[model samples]
Target: MSRKNRHEEHEEHADESWLLPYSDLMTLLLALFIVLYAASSVNISKLEELSKAFDNAFSSGISILDKSALIEAEDEQNKSQKQRHEEIGIRTQQEKLMAQEQEDLEKLKKELDQYIDKNGLVTQLETQLNQSQLMITIRDNALFASGSADVKPTAQKLAVAIGLMLQKYPDYEVLVSGHTDDHPISTSEFANNWELSSQRALNFMEVLLQNQAFDPKKFSFIGYGEYRPVDTNDTEAGRAKNRRVEVSILRKYTDSSATNTVLSAISDEANSAPSTTTSN
Candidate 1:
């Protein structure tokens, strides 16, 4: 009875021991397959999740595949953070430049206002400073006689003073715009108001350009004729107000058109320069 019992117990235990080694082999294969799959995908989140599952099921720490994925993920995160910070820095710098430009224009406006006040020319001149530009408006009577585009001798001093002040801001672009009353004109010297207005703007700009302190490339002129009127032409006072010239120092941020104008001016100058032949 004892021999039969011992033999049966030994057989049962031998089959059970074989199953333990076979189970260990299957577990090792499964771990190898999981690591290979993780290597192929290379996702940090998925790798961590799978590692946590393996840790719960086994006595091991994180796998090599999971660690590699984690390293890659950290690298990508650092790159993304760096790029975002760079973009923010660039945006902040742009905002700072725009604010500085506004401050400079405001300072110029104050100086012009002080000069106009000291000269007692408030009736004939006015200054306005905004985000887009700093403008000085001069009444027609101060610069020219009736039906004439010629700048008065006294007005030349005013233009010189303005041109000198403009030298302080060498980076800015200046625009001299001429406006006229709604009344039409046709004369031997001028064909129409357009011709008169254009001549007036050109002549005034020529006077300002005489000061070598200012860059010729920075100045441009336009004659609006009677189209861009700020006041009604129905009254004498309003008509007088409309007949004026504006000297504008344009701000760069809100003035894309001004940049195009400046670029166009540069192109024109480049094209107008006389070509010379070079001998080889």
Candidate 2:
């Protein structure tokens, strides 16, 4: 009876040994499910970190998760570099266009200057190239009679000449502005300096439009009246300077320093060149 009891206890011990292996198998399956859930939810960067941890712990080689993260990072970097290169190319093209525009304006200025010299109109007309615009200033007396807005019949020829010269650059925006001396005036045709100045600018602009080549949409006109004077109204000479009409060719791109450099170069060339006029 004692021997049989010992045998029964041994059998029970051996059966429990099988249970230990079964419990271990269940634990391993639970761990695999948890790993699968984490992988599905984690981002690539986090997955790479997890892969590194697994590699260290198990002495495994490079994981597929790490390789995928590295490839994505490299693709992002390449896309960023491509975007930078495209922006640089666009900037370079814009710069080239601006340079071409500046060259065209400079050529136009030279042609107009030569015409002014040839006609001996320097006393009545002046041209200035600046950062904002290329301005052509004409004495009001050259265009209109005293207190009158009508352009003088002889002076219409000058307007025609200027209009023809402007035809070369049809794309530029043109502004015609009229200014007057501070001397107050009330007449049958004009109630004040404002009306007089406005009519003068309008009439002058009309003459400029006679050349069918100009785009009327690109032209604008304004009257400054007695205000916006360039010279003091105290003296006759100053008043003469103050009463003027300005035709401004507006610039598409304005840079003061770059314009100054261009102006300096133009001035140097003018000073060195012979004082001779050539017909356009």
Candidate 3:
């Protein structure tokens, strides 16, 4: 009787067998999730090695994660090839545009040359075509009065004619630049060569812009005064040559080596050509 009472008094032990396997299952789930996250962001070279690890861990020849990695790599390659093709297309289009620009400029130069020759205006105007731009250099006396920035009444027709020609190239940027001889001048009406040159360019540009067909935004003017000169300022004839107005139709695209070659050819032609203006 005493032994039976002692056995009943002994505490009941709880079942602890379920915990070990449950903990192991949670650990495995965490590792799987970690591997999936890494696979998404990893480099292709590293992801291949990780795909092998996934196969080893799952005891399979190829896991779902490995298939995902293959899909990602294929997508990246396709994107790269597409981008390269787009770049090639853009470059080809640019080349075509430049070729057309050159052809148009050449045609315009010939037309202007014909007009100058037919009108007996070769002595007052000249044109040069190069890779950089098509330049029209006009003698100052042809457009402006002595010691004045105002355009002459007779020159209005010339301006209107040039404006008509420029209407075809609405996209080109036209730069009208004024240059002056080194002789100094200061007066109530005019201060110096800078003011004189600037006014000359502005006034002429206004005349060109009066034509509604020409876009005002595509035109600009500047004054170089006596700083930029094509001829020497030491002699009267040279000074007359130096004081001139130039209109340059700028190039949209430029390649330095190609431009240099074209410029050299133009220079050779210019040196061989006869003088367009005589000394005042």
- Colliding residue pairs in candidate 2: none
Error of 3 at 107 (Å): 1.1
Query: How many clashes show up in model 1?
Result: 0
TM-score result, candidate 1? 0.66
Candidate with better TM-score, 1 vs 3: 3
TM-scores, one per candidate: 0.66, 0.66, 0.67
Off by over 4 Å in 1: 1-77, 254-280
Itemize residue pairs with steric clashes in candidate 1.
Answer: none
Q: What's the TM for model 2?
A: 0.66
For all candidates in order, the CA lDDT equals 0.81, 0.81, 0.81
Candidate 2, number of clashes: 0
Candidate 2 lDDT over residue span 1-280, tens digit each: 9999999989887745688889999999999999999878858898899988988756666567877899999999999999999999988987897787789888888989999899888999999987778899999888888888889997899999999888999988787888888887766677777667767888999999999999999887767677678988889998899888989887776675653443353245324422321110
Q: Return the top candidate by TM-score.
A: 3
Worst 10 residues of 3 by lDDT: 271-280
